[model samples]
Structures are given as structure tokens and as C-alpha cells.
Target: MSLVLAGTVAGLVLGDAWLWVAVEWSPPAYAGFYASGGFDTPTTVALLVAAPVKAALLWLILRAPAPGPLDRRARALRRLLYLAVAHALVLWYPIALLPDVVGAVFQLALWSAIDVLYLLVIRWRSRMLRAAAGVAFAVELAGTADEVLDELDLPELGSSEVAAAVLMLGGAAAIIITLVGQRRDGRWSRGTQAAGWLSVGVYALVIPFGVFFEGIPGGGPVLPVVMGVMALVGTVWLAATARELPVEDRPADPPPARRRVTRVAVAAVAMLPVIALIHPEQTPHLTHTGWSPACYDRPGFGDLKPAERDAAFLCRARSTDGGVPPMFPDGLSDQEVLAYGRVLCRAKDHDEQEAVLTRAGSARAAWGADPWDLVYVCPEIVGAAHPELLRSAAETEAANDAHIAEMNAECRDPWPRTKGVVQATARYFLFADGDHGYLVHDPGDESAEGEMDQAIDELYDDGDALVGAVGSTVLVGHVEDVTDLCLTVKAFRTAPPRRLAGWDQVTEVPVVSRSGRLTVPELDGGDAGAGAPMPNLAIAGKGRYRLRVHVRVGDAGEEHLVVVFPGASRKRLELKS
Candidate 1:
């Protein structure tokens, strides 16, 4: 009865956690940004996927169990425990992947050894599954807090000395509640907990190797799916524990372990959070090393193992002579050579670095705006030299400036003075990070993906456009029909309300005005920069400006309210009477 009760409680808490994430935790703004913009990050994906799995398992548990319910419940509860640990491992494993195949194996081997040794030497196992689960939960919500805070820009919450991530401890709280409640039921013996942790740890060690080397079913996001499956089964197992059964069927607890080792287990489990918190920034590394490429020698990374500390940081490595790297087309890969060049570019002496800068400048003149070339790579190495790279083509810059001035004078400012409409393709539009995703995605280009579906059913989902904006530039979506898209423009001195009444969706982006005139081009047109000239909005002086795009749809066509502010884009554009 106690086991059933505990299992029932565990089922409820797990369901609740899923409910909390799906409903209360995920903000509309942040979640929508990710969903529509196609920014499916790992943590975001895990949180979304785990919630549904837990919910489904909760449903499965609610149904009547087959004969021998007690045994089924016990097995299910054990899987549930493993599932919890799997969620925790999702965050830790990504850090390990960047390290070479051998480094990953070694880390897992050491962990497995310690896990085995705990049982052999101390006669018991220590598990930090819950603590790790907590850290993973915190990390997931932290991204949400960051995104929301970025949008809201609250002074008190945003300006605080404490990291905004700390505020997103709701996930940690949910896991803690589930673990604490499970402890209330004595049926959750130390042996049962140990077994569950062991199973999950093995999965963590084994899965990454297959993902990194052997290849998983999905090309990407295999970890989240793997963790979600473990958790799914685990939840179902817990729910089964609530089944009606005899008390005599309950599993027996193992004998108590050595007294001294209890502290060891607790202390060791406590350190897992420390290890989980240190997220290292990525360094450019074409080759796999003994440690994660990102695990450079930073002071606070004391939590990192010794192997990681010893490996030279990929970015700062120098040649044999400690001078500039070997000339282009050396033994090193282009990326490695670039890293060395960047090292020389950052050097203090201009006279010493002048040769490289001059060469990069000449390359810029020859390449002329082709991306990923020498001109593009050098700027990140020395940002101040960005203009210097461009200045090599003085005649070109002058011609471009003259062209801009000519275009600005020929501004297509049409609205209050003359009434007309702009043409739009259809309903669903998207504002995304990459320009090529929705526009001009070359059919032959293998690298271009995650955009474009020609099927008409994709356009008819709900009739409303599923447009989103992660950044200002690219907008793409499905629309079955093309129609006249009209716009009502207003200019404000101050930043206006982000959304307006009756608009389906609204977003704002900062746009630069070099000629005091900015154009609103076809964001969701056929080919990029291929159609007719777009109308321009003129401002008084040069600087930064904001474009607040308010979109709404009707049976006839889609309507847009473009509000322009010096920054807010809120001021009313009072026409000259």
C-alpha cells in the first residue's frame, strides 16, 4: 500500500512538473520566438519534449494496470528514477562531446569506476542524480529568463548584481519537490535509488559515444530524445506503482552499508552542481584534443578535471618559433591557420602587425564583399581595422556613398500624401536570424536547410501567419495567395507600445539610417532583392532608428502598421494639414 501510494504521488508530481513547464513556465514571447523563428536550441527542446512525455506517461499510468500490478509498479518506479537522472545528464554530456572520442571515453570510464568502487568499497552507492537534475532544470529556465528579461528590460530585475539565471530556479524547485516527496515513502529504499542511478549513468556514458561516433537515428538532438525516452518509461513505471496490490509483494531492502562512506556519497553528490555550472565558451578547434575545445585554462574552471586544464586553449596556440603562423596553405587546416593569424593580429605593436593588416586589406580589395574570405576573418581578430580593410577600395566606397545619396534623394515616401498598398505573398511570414532560410535558399546548396516547404497544406494550418522575429532581417512563411498588402505608417519621437490593438502579431527592430532614409523592402517576396523598388521612410538626421511592424490579417489580405520612432518608434506621424 505504501509503495502504491508513493508511486501514485510520484506520478502526480511528475505530471505536475510537465504541466508547469508547458503552461506556467514557458512565456509566450520567448517560446514563440523559438518556435516560429526555428531556433530549436537543445535546452529549449528538452524542456518542451520532456513535458509532453511526462504528461503522456501520467496518462498511461492513470489507466488500469494488468494482473500482477505490484511487480509492474516496482519496475516502473525504478525506470522513473533513472529517467530523472537522464534529464540531469543531458546538460553534462554536451560539455563532454567537444572533447575527443578518447577524452569522452576516459571521463565516462573514471565516473563508472568511481560508481563501481562506491559499491565494492563502501557497500553502497552515492547518487547526485537529483542535484544534477536541479542544475539542468535551472539552466533550462535560465535561458527563458534571459530572453524575457531582454525583451522586458526591467530595471530592477535586469540590473541586479545576482545573475538573472538564479531567478529561474522553478525547474530546480520542481525536481526537488518530486525527490523529497519520493523520500516520504519508505518503499524508495537506498538499493532501489542506487540501481536507478546506475542504470541512468550507464546510458549517459554509452549514448554520447554512439551519438558522436557511430551515429544515432536522428542526425541531431539525439540526447534530448534519448533522455525523453528514459524519462517516459520511468514516469510510466512510477504511475504503475499506484496499482492495487498486496503489501507482501513489496521488494526487500538491502543491508545497510559501512557508516563512514555515507558522508562520502553525500559530499561527492554535492560536487556535481559545481561541475555542471561551469559552461565554457567555445574556442575554434578543427582537431579533437584530450579535453573539450572550449575548456581553456580559466581561473574558475577548478571544477574541470586535470586533463582539460593541461590541454592548450585552441585559440591562443602559437607556432614553433612563437611568431606569425606558417604562410597560407601550411600543414594546419584553414581554421587553425586563421586562429594563429588572429593571435598575431591581436599583438600590440602596429609596426609588427602592419604586414598582415596590409595583406588582409589587399585581399579585401580583391575579394570585394565575398563572405568568409580573408577580409571577413581579420575583422574579428582586430575590430578597429574593419574600416581599414574596406578603405583599400577608396574609389568603390566613394561610388557606394554617391549611390546611397542618389537613392536617398529618390526616396519612395508614400503614405499620407498619396494612398497606395504594397503587395504581399500570403499569411505565414517569419523573421529569422539567417537570410537564406526563407529567401533565396539554393536548391543545390547542401548547407542550406530548415526552410522552404512547397506543399500547400503547410500554408493552411490555421489561416494566421506563423511569422516570428529573432533578429531584424529575414522574414519567411507560407501563404496560399498573393494580395495587396497595405501599410499605415506613423513616426514617433519616443519608443511606442510594442504591440497595437487589433494586430495579430507585432515586433520591433533597430535599423540604421546612413542617408537619413530607410527602405521597407519585400521581407516575404519571391527572390531576395529581385522585385520592384520598395518605398523608403525618411528621418531628419543619420543614426539609429526603430521599425515597429504590426501585422493583422483578414479575408481579403494582410495589413501592416509600421510605426517609426527615433528609438521607440512611438510618435504619431501628424500629416501637414
Candidate 2:
């Protein structure tokens, strides 16, 4: 009953471990197989079934007649097998539970060794079976070490490929030598015969697939599937042969439990070096949060492209000055960081944008939140540029109300007035950063304007229009990168809200702006000296209005909102009325 209870507990522990692996490490398609609730019914049922099955098998084996006194060689092999099983089982725990294929192959070999060794302990003499299992054990041990070295990104110990080749060649030679010279028991159980054939068959199948079809370290499912089949077959064979042990006279009284424990402890000490070699946690490119290619050796970003380098520069400056990344703890992926760089590069002042990012980062840190969480959701980083941090909520609100009133009267109002001064602001837009790039129409001809436009246009598809209209200047440049870029425009009353929407409106401009830029073609084809400016999106009422232009470049579309302010025109037109 004690042995039965121990088997039951072992079964439960193993089943729970398997369940944990399935839930946390399985591929997305397979995760759901065992990831239901706290009390997983399938896992529970499997564990319970295994408990009684294993318990019964143990009871039968214990009840069987004991073996006659072993010869010197047999006793040595028994001790060696015990050591191998103990050390290999520890290594196999994490490796078998890993969801990847490289692990599965190692796990199959370790499991096979354990099974064959256990059978030998019970005196099921099969020399051919022992030889095949021994060969598999050697190959898997070398293969697992090779794989672990590569996964850890450690310096190679010779070539893993060469090592695997030599190990496999030796195993093949051992199998041939055993088959020619060794012998099996005259009367083998059907299960034992089947298990032996299956073992050889699996060993033959794994080598070629692992070498030619699938490269070592990582790949498709051939090896994993073969290993899985091997495990299933080995388990079935173990169960079938559990009752086929040879009858023997009762042996001398069993050794004391304390003596047995001491022997086991001595074996473990002898195999410490073997156990120390299997370190899976040291594998590279993995972190507590998750695997991110973006996090790999990206310190200086020397490997990045030119634009990504600029992003890296900006990130470095921000971190140096503000003690935080503009993005976050891990930073953005290559393209995203570049896009953000383009946005910052286009700003009228680099110092201002850096200051804004710094303040934002500081605020996020104060709140114990990620910098990216603040930046992605923050509104202050929008438009030609963000303004100074509002000192007070009331002051922010008052400024917002005044700006809205001015915009409504000059840009949103519908009226005819005397020609007012046409102010021209040379705003620049960049598109190189993919989806994260924004269109800006600021008031100034900064030195970085052309560069910013070039980068932004790089993001545009060929034949796409580069529409820029600020104050009275509207010039459309064609996207020369590819021929699929085009423009779409719309009007709206309110700007789109960002992820963090509850921020004070007075501190930041709305995403939509009527006076920022224009993409609407002018009616009557009027040229504004240099080129055709987009038609003046003139508002004819004393209210707020927004013109949203959507530029479709390839599969993605970018939206630019310019809130048109008529300025003094609305008052002059009202006076005329």
C-alpha cells in the first residue's frame, strides 16, 4: 500500500508538471489542449489512470521472485545503469517538459535508456536490446550537449554537426558489432521482441530526419513526431513486459533500506559532472517577460540601418539626459524606433521634443509605469510639436477655450471677408517610419525640412501624393518610391483621441487641426507662385471645422488633420455684414 501510494503521488506530480509545460510553453495551437482551468479535468483523469496502472505494475514487479546472485560484470552494469538513469532523469525533467523539438529528441533518448535499464535490473536478458539502447543513449547525450551549447549562444566545442556525426557513426558501429556477436535470451516475450525492433526502428528514423530534413537546434516536426511515437511505443512495451519477468528462487535477505539509500547517494555523487552539464536556463534571447528579437545585443545599435541609427541616437540622448528610454525598458523594434526618430527629427526644435519625451518619461517613472505605456497613450507628443507643460488645469482650460474661439472664428466660420494676409509656414512631413510616422505642418523652414520630407516620402508608395498645405502654401509632391501611393481626404469636428484621453486639453493640441495642413485641390486651378497649393480649405461659418486628409501608401493609410483658422478674416467679414 505504501508503494502504491508513492506511485499515485509520482503519477500526480508528473501529470501536473506536464500540464504546466502544456499551459506555459506549448505552441499557441497546442496550448489549449491542457490550459482550461485550475482544475484541469483531462490532466486529472490521466494522472488518476496512470497512478493505479503504475501502482499495479510496481506491485507485480515487487511480488516477482528475486534474481540469483549477479556476476561481477552484471553487478557493475547494474551500478552503471543506476547512475545513468538518476543523472539522465534530472536532465530529462526540464528537457522533456520543453515544448520544442530539440528537447523532444533528447527526452526520447533519456526515456529509452531508463526503460531499457529498468528491464535489465529485472533480469530480462536481451543483449541486442541492450546494445541498441546503449547506442541511443550515447547519441542522445552528445546531441543534447551540442544543442544546449548552440541554444546558450556559447562558443562551440568543436562543431556540433561534426560531433553529432561522430557520435552517430560510433553508435552505428556498436549496433553492427552487437548484432554480429551478442545474443538474446532464447525465449523472449512478444513485448520484448517488439520493443527491441521498435527501438532500432526509431533510432534509424531519427538520424536522417535530424540531419538532412531538419537542421539541429530548431526546425519542423519530423523528429518531434518520431520521438513522440517512440515514447508511446516504449511505454506500451514497458506495460506489456511488466508481467513477463523470469521466475527465480528467493534471494538472500534484501539489503537494509539505509544501506540502499547510501548506495544511491554515492551513485548521485559520482554522476555530478554529468548532471551539471544540462543547463537550459542559460539559453540566450529569453527573458522573464518573454522572447524579443528587439532585445538582442541592441546596446549601440551598430547593426541597425541609417535611419534606425538615428533613432538609436535619439534614444541614447534621451536616456543620457532624462535617464529613461523614449519607448521603454526594452525600447521599440527597429522600424518603430526609426519612425519615432523621423517624427522627432521633423520637429521645429530637437531640444523641445527631447524635453517633452524626458518629461513624459519622468512622469511615467513617477507613476511606476513603463515609458512606452505613457508615450503610446500620451497626447502631448502630437502635431507640429507639443507646447510647454501646463502649469495649472484652469490656465490650460482657459488657453484651450481662447484658441478654440479663435479657430472657430477664423478657420471654421463661414463668411466672405476682405483679403487678409496669407501667411506661409514651411511645415515638413516624414514617412520613413512606416505606420508610426506622422504628418506635421509647423511654421518654419528648419534645415532638417528636406531631409524629413525625403524620409517621409520614402515611406510613401510610388505614385502616392505628398500633400502639404500650411497657412497659404499647399504643394503636392508625388511619391517616387513606388506607384501605388494615393491620397483620401475627409472633414471632422473633433480630433481622434489617443490611448490616454483624460489628459488636460489645454496642454496639447487635438490630433485634428484645421490650420495645420491641406490636401484639397484648389478650385479654378490657381497657382500660388511655386506650384499648385491644395485648395484653401476655407471655412464659411463662425464655428469649428477640421479637414482630415488620408494618404494611402501601399496597404497602410496615414491621416493628417489640419484645423483651418481664418484668423482676422472672420472678424473683418462680420464687420462687413
Candidate 3:
């Protein structure tokens, strides 16, 4: 028994040391789901409780007289082991109360299973005690019902978090108190004392640090292998020790039955908790489960393993459905639209991505008009991975040109003669960041250049120039060739299609000037590398104004439309298509 405790102590110490090595070698990549780790909170709470309980059991066992009959020492050890398990059940109770009903059944079935095992070992006495414990636990917690409710309503905490925290704490305290009451000692061993304390001390430090900090470095794979091994070893150790003790000299239970039954019962007792939590939604922290996966597979997806469903549901996907990034439901900002483009860039489901883009572009338009997002989505994906289902950039641009040439054949309204409005054009190589200019209220700010610098990763990863943000500025993307661009300015009385087709995008942005006037930068395609930012043309006084920039693409060039209004938000509205 003492030797078994020593192995546990050694395992705990070595595991923590390995953890330090892993963290130094390969720290967490805090970008993925779960802040990029597994179910961090519940697992941490479990470890905090389990460590001290196991330590107390080891101490109770060591205090017993060496390898003797079923005495006071043996009974005390058994009761402490029971307390460790009941504490685990207490931990599961709140976690099981998640969003679905499957979790609830799993929880109750698990409690029933544990009761079966408890009765076979400790007889009828354990059940009576368990029922009494349950009653007392409820009564004790009833006093703080209002506090729990208040905590749940807080913005930082919710039903899942608050309930788990409160119940887990109560469970831990109950476990410790129950173990303390069964304290049996003549203080038989100092070496055993060292081993038990060492296990408790190391576990308390390592588990919490691993959870709340940068996360276990190689913890993704390393943790499960180490924990699984420890569990197997502990089960074997306890089972072997239990064989030596005589719980009773009753007639119905023979020697052979006691030997085989006792060992098997001990093993099942250790494993019942593991069996209870097999649902994909409630990820098993002690075992290997994909808490967050990279690729999402819809019903029509060719071949893939099941990822955590909660993650997919968050992306608005389900078992038979496809998903989009969490955007589009609310009014979008320029940054949000830019961020959505980035998600589309990395999407594996090319067909689904294209469908989402095309559908959003075309069908959502009210009357007969063009899509505002016609300039977006595909170009963004092209810059990233070149989505499989979409056409090549050359083909798409050629189609856009032919589409515009057809639209230009229709009679259109003349450009509006309005103040606070001017048109400027430039030659930009689409794939290259050559000489593409932007619309800004402050010509002197140069923050647009800083904004360009901020998009270095996008540029490096996908050769993209289209996505960026700076204060009071809206940037443009690169084109395939240095195409001839014609600028056009307009002011809309009401939101409607200024033209029937050929419009790629029309979105809003703020333009402010305290000096009562500012210069709009001219794009002359000179030696400045990116359209030569030498100030030139028109100026306008502004007070609180927003620019609704319109981009209409054609074979000849792109006609940019900037419609000045009194608001600032990046909303890609539908034109009557």
C-alpha cells in the first residue's frame, strides 16, 4: 500500500517537471477556439479537488497496521475513497446542466451506476449515507440561492459558469470534511507522509497554472497520455491493496468470490466517472478530445471526422448544415467585413463559401439592381488560397468587364453637381499593390500608410491589398493589371440604385474636418510607387459628413462613386438587381 502511494507521488512530481519542459519548448497558440485549449475551468476544479482527496486516502491507509484483518484502519480508508468519488459526482452535477437534455440523462445514469458499485463494497450503509449527504448538500446550498442567481445574471458569468463554480466548491469542501471526520492515526510512517504531501503539493501548483495561464504548452497531446497512464496505475495499486484487507467474514461471500469480485469492483469503481461523460459536446478534459478543430464539415462534405458540435453551432452550422463566420446577422463595420473576408480566405468548403457569397450578393437585393458585395468575397478568397470552386481572377475580371459593357448600354443619370464631392482615378495592378489610392478626409494624416503596414500578414499570406482600415479613410485593393480608372461622384437623395448594373460596392465611412476644409489626394500614377501621394486637386469644407463610396467595374476601367451623406457605418446594401 505504501509503495503504491510512493509511485503516485513520483508520477505526480515527474509530470509537473515534464510540464515545465513542454511549456518552455512549445507554449500555447492563443488564437484558436477555447482561447485555444480544452475545457479549462471544470478540469481545473476537478484536479484541485482530486489531488487533496487522494492525498488524504494515502495518509489514512499508511496510518493502518501493516497488512492485517479488516480493522478500524481498513474501514477508514474505504470511507475516504468513497468521499473522493462522491466529490467527483458533485463536480459533474452542474456541468451536466448544459444547453441540452442528453447531458441530463447521462448525469443521472452515472449517479445510479456509482450507487450500484458503492452498495456491493460498503453494503447498504453507503446508500443511506449517500442519500443523507444529498439532502444535507441541498439544504446547505439553499441558503445561498439568491447569490447563485445573481452571479448567473452577471455579464461576465452565466448559468454554465456560475453553477459549475458554486457546486464544485461545495463538493470539494464536503469531500475534505468527510475525509477529515474519518481520520485514523497512530502516525505509523514519516516516509508515507512525505509521499502523500508531495503529491498534493505538486498537483495543486501544476493544475491551476496549466489552466489559467498560457495553457500547457504541449498539453494538447501530452496531458492525455500522462493522465491515462496515472489512472491505470492508481487503479491497479488500489485494487491490489484492497485484496489484502478483510471487510467481513460473512458466509454468503466465499474466498474466491471475494478475491475476483473485490478486484473487479475496485477497477469498475475507478472507471464509472470516465464512462459517464462521453458526449462530444461536453469534452472530456482528462482524455483526448478535439475541443476545437480547424476544418468544419457540413452534411455534403466528402469525408471528415466530427468536430465539437458547439463550435459548429456557433458558426451557425448544424449536423445537416454548412456554416459562415459569425457575421451578417447585425450591421457590419468595415473591419467586420474585412475580417469575414479573412475567414472566407481560409475556408475549405469552396462550394459552400461561394454559395454564401453569391446568395448574399444577388438574392438579398430588393428590386432589379446589382449586388454591393460584387467586389468583395471572391477577390478576398483569391488573395488567400484561391478557392477551388471559384473561377480564376482573370476569368472573373473579364466577366465583370463584359457585364459592365452590357450595363453601360443602358441610359443612366448624369453625375450630381454637389459640394463636398470630387472624383479622382488611378491605374492599379490588381495582384500587385501598385498605385492604388483611397478616399480620406485628412490628406496630411499619412495614417493610411500605417494602416497599410498593419495589413502585412494579409499581403504576405494572400497577396491581398483590398482589406484595411484607418481613421477617416477607406482603402482600395490591387488589380491584375494597371487598368484605366475613371472616377465619378454622386449624392443620393434616398437610398436606391443610382444605376441598374455594373456597381460592385457602395459602403459608408466618416469624413471630418475641424479646419472647415481639406484636400482630397490626387492619384496621377507617378514615381511615388503607390500612385505618388503628391497633393493636387479639389478641396471641400466639411462639418459632420459620411461618404458612400461606389465602385463600378468595367472592361475599360473602374468608376468609383463617393456619395456624401450624414452617417458612418460599413453597410453593404442591396441595389435593385
Candidate 4:
């Protein structure tokens, strides 16, 4: 029964916030063990079985006839044992198990109430303690009922809040009453008597079934109700079983100072283990070297060994000496190599470290191959020169930007404005160079306009113009000829160059005005520049003409340009020299 009580308290503690406290107090080694599934089966069963056994053993010991006076050390050991049992039943078990939030609140209330009742009983030798204890028990019953009502999601105060509030208030009142009763009786030691009786009730009634109740299927509601019924049954049984012993037969109190000292010693010993249990620390000898079972040792880990495991751990350590080694040397498999590569790519490597990256164009490809192996085998190949790399990177960047824009369009959100500016700037440079190249500029600041202008001036020194600011969105074009040709613009914000195709011819007609104006014949045999202000025209072909504006600023506060071509191809535009 005592074991059962301790186990019940333990369960309550486990399910409540006390469990978190226990976790915090647990030694690092224990915590690691707990984390690694050490407590999953055996520990749980031990706790359940041990509580009742300990309680029964204590009951038997306490009932045993008094022995001859013991040695000091023996007495101390006995006291220590008693204290250990009390602390475990009162603190450890309660905090480690039991799921009822309201039950916990009620249990605390009952404890307090019983304390008060015992105080009153000792002070007056009055029958009022039993009544008071009964009343306290009743309050606990009411609180549990309230909790059940709340779980049904009734309109009343949900769950334990109201029950806890009532318990605390009622318990406080009971304590005050008991204190007053004790003072009136001039019995300063009544508190101790009350505690003894309460302990008896806790041992005999609360634990046995408390442990049993928690184990039942659908136990939550049923357990509390059954416990309440049991409390009533137990109260009746105690009343029926009550027997009057002669007053002189009761144990006499020891001297006040000695008794106080004894109680203090007992409490101190009881608290030692609790304190130790509460503030767990790590020991050097029990360090864990492997991954936690909760994480790395889970299901599907078996699928990870050959390729996933190898790729994840091996390739990363591979040497920097270039050229692929046999798929795996030294018993290492391809998957392991890939895994190593993947991990290595993410790790910090020196500048000269030549890393291999396998390009799986899509996610499907990525998942299909051993992902880890792909990490090492994938080559991050870039153009040799800075300009070429920049150009390729810019095209790749532009394509990415366009894809984002497409997604944004479907979502009806404004396209990213910064991307437009970058794309336009990249296009302007790409056209002037007439070949793919890298854009060398300070990455620390977005104000790459100065660097862009320098690149433009150096690349196209004659008869070229930069007519757009970084933040404009519209693009316009003028040209002098008509011909079949392809126009490609590699934007820094796009993933790849955009090839505008199907042009007949192209001609660069010089503008006479500083405002960058030029005129060219229209497709309908009329002057296309006649009634409008002309921009300098680089015409594509004679009859069916297309034009390209190297750079233009738009009204929507973004910058980009339209490279006009009749079809999508990389063929060069024919320039009339």
C-alpha cells in the first residue's frame, strides 16, 4: 500500500510539470540514457512495480515490535532509510508520473488539509480532525469532479484552474483553523501528530489504488471517479473499524528539544536524496560516444549505410588532389564517396580545395541517385576567365530571376524590383561585349553602377550609350535595318540568357541629335521616325525590321531592355558597317 501510494505520487509528478523538473535535475549521464531509450520499458516497469513493494515493506517495518535500543550508527541508518522512503514517496514519485493536472492540485490540497486536521487532533485530542480530514477529502473530490466537467468542455471554468484555486484557498483556510485550534489547546506539537495520521492515510488509502487506477484503460476519468468512490468507501471502512484505545496506551512524547532535533535530522536526511535527485550533474566516466537512438538510431537508418552513410561521411574527407579515384578505394563504395562529398561541400575548405559537385538538373534526379555520392562527383565547373564566369553566372542568375517573376505573377504579387535592375544592367554589358563574361564588381554594396559604367565604357568605346538608371522597368528600342537574326541578352538576375529570335536584318543608323535620335524606313514603305521624336536606331533588316535598345529605363521604377530578334537563336545580327 505504501509503495502504491509512492508510485501514485510519482506518476502524478511525472505527468505534471514536475517531470520537466526531474529532467532538469537528472544527471547528464542519466539524461543521456533517458534520451537514448534507456527508460522506455524497464525503468517504467520498475517504477510501477517498486512503489507498492516498498510501501508494503515499510508498513510491515513500522508495525514491528520495538527492538532494544540501537547503536547510534544503526539509529542513524534507520532514520536515513525512513527519510529516503518519505522523500521518494512525497517528492520523486509524485513529480515523475500521474497525468491529472486537477488531481495534482487536489492532492496538494488534500495534503495541506490533512496536515491541518492532524494539528487539530493532536491539540485537542478531539474527534474534529477526522471530520476536518473528511471535509478536505471532500474538497479534493469536488475538484476532481470539476476537472472532469471541464474536460467535457463544459461552459464552466475549463480543467483545473478553478479546482486549483478552490483547493489552495480551502487548504489555506483549513491550515488557519488547525493553527488556531492548536493555539487554543496550548499544544505546540499538534502539527506532528496530524502529520503522522495523515501519513497513515496516505500509505493505506491513496497509493495502492492510485497506482492501479492509472493503469486501467480509459483510466483518466474512470480513475478519478473510482478514487473518489474509494475515498468514500475507505472513510466508511475507517469509521466502522475505529476502536478506542486507552489514552495511556498511546506513545508518550519525548523531550521537546530532543524531539525537535530528531525531526530536523529526519527531515535533513530525507531531503538529501531528493536534493541529489533534483540537481543531477554529469560524471566524466559515463560519457556517450554514439548518436542518440531517438535521432540516428531510428527506423530507416538501415537504408542509410552503403550510399547515404558513405556519401555523408566519406567524400568530405577526400584529398584535394584532382581527378576522380576509382569510384571507391579501400572498400569505400560510390554512395559513401557521394555522402562524403556532400558533407565536405558544406564544410569549410581552403581556397585551393578542388571540390566536385554532381549536377542533377532537377530534384527528381537528386533523389534518385545516391544523394551523398552526388555531392562529391558533381563538378562546380565555371568559365576560365572572370568575364566568362561572370557572364555565365549572370545568365544563370537571370533565368532564376525570371522563374521567380513567373511564380510571383501566378500569385499576383509584384515582381521583385531589384532583379529587374540587375537583369537590365547585365544585358547592357552582355550586348556591348558580344560574348559571355563575368561582371567584376564589389559585392558588398548594391551600388555597382560605377563599376558597371566602367565596364561598359571599356568594352564599347565608340558610338554606344547607357540610357537607363538601375531602377527603371521599361525597355524601348530603335534600329536601322531588317534581317533574320537572333538576339540574346544575359541578365545577371536570370539563370540563363534569353534568346530572342526571327529577325530579317539589322543596321546601325547614326543619330544626328544628342537626344539619341535616329530615323529608319518603316515596313509599310513610309519613314518610321517621321512624326515622332527619334531615338538612335540600330535597325535589324531592310523590309521586316527589328530594333534593340542596349539599355532603357522604365516608368515602373525598374531597369531592363528588350533585345529584339525575329526568332530564338544565337545567330549574330548582321551589322551594316
Evaluate candidate 4 by giving its C-alpha RMSD to the native, one decimal.
22.4
For TM-score, candidate 2 versus 4, the one ahead is 2
Which candidate achieves the best lDDT against the true structure? 1
Roughly what TM-score does model 3 have, to 2 decimal places? 0.23
Per-residue alpha-carbon lDDT of model 4 for 456-517, expressed as tens digits?
Answer: 45334434322211211112222322211112222221222332232222222111111222
lDDT for every model? 0.39, 0.37, 0.38, 0.34
lDDT of 3 by residue, 1-577 (tens): 3444454455346653323222211122321222344435443343334444444554443344334455564555555444433334244445545643444344334433333333333332355555554553453343234344454453322236565456535533433322222222212222322223333333333344344333333444334423422332332223323332352331233367555665554455445444543446434232211122222332211121234322322222111123323233222333343444445445466565565544445222222211112223333434344332244445655665564445444323224433323333333223234544544445554444565454344334545233233444445443334443444444333333444445665445445444443333443333222132322221344444555555665665555555555434554333421
**lDDT of candidate 4 at residue 326, scale 0 to 100:** 27
Please identify model 1 stretches exceeding 4 Å from their true place: 1-175, 185-187, 193-254, 258-338, 343-403, 407-577
C-alpha TM-score for every candidate: 0.27, 0.27, 0.23, 0.23
User: Candidate 1 — what's its lDDT?
Assistant: 0.39
N/CA/C clash count, model 3: 12
Candidate 4: residue 76 lDDT (0-100): 42
Off by over 4 Å in 3: 1-160, 170-210, 213-577
What's the C-alpha lDDT at position 30 in model 2? 37
User: Candidates ranked by lDDT, best first?
Assistant: 1, 3, 2, 4
lDDT of 4 at 283: 20
Q: Per-residue lDDT of 1-577 in model 2, one digit per residue for the tens?
A: 3654564465456654443333222333332333433335544554444445444433433333234465554454444443443333234455556755666455445545544544355432556666565665556455555555666676644465576567665544443333222224322243333444444444555554443334222333323433443443333333333333332332233457745664554455335435534446533211211132222333322234544434333343234234433333333333443344445444455465555445444333332322222232222443113332312345555675564344323321111131222222111223433332333332232422464455445334433334433333333343333211222222323343321222111111112223443333321222111111333333333323332232222233221223343233211111010
- Cα lDDT tens digits, model 1, 1-577, are 2333344345345653332234223223433332443324564445545555455544554555335433443444434434433333343444445544443343334333322322222211224544444454445345444444454444334344255435444333433433343344343444334323433333344434443334222334335344444544433433333332222233564445642354445444445445544445453333422233242333222233445322323322221134434233223443555554564555566454545434543222222221112333354543355443333345445665564445334323223342223221222223333232132112232422342333123323435433322212223332323323444455655665444456566655444454555444443334333123344443445555665566556663555556555663433221210
RMSD of 3: 22.5
Error of 3 at 428 (Å): 36
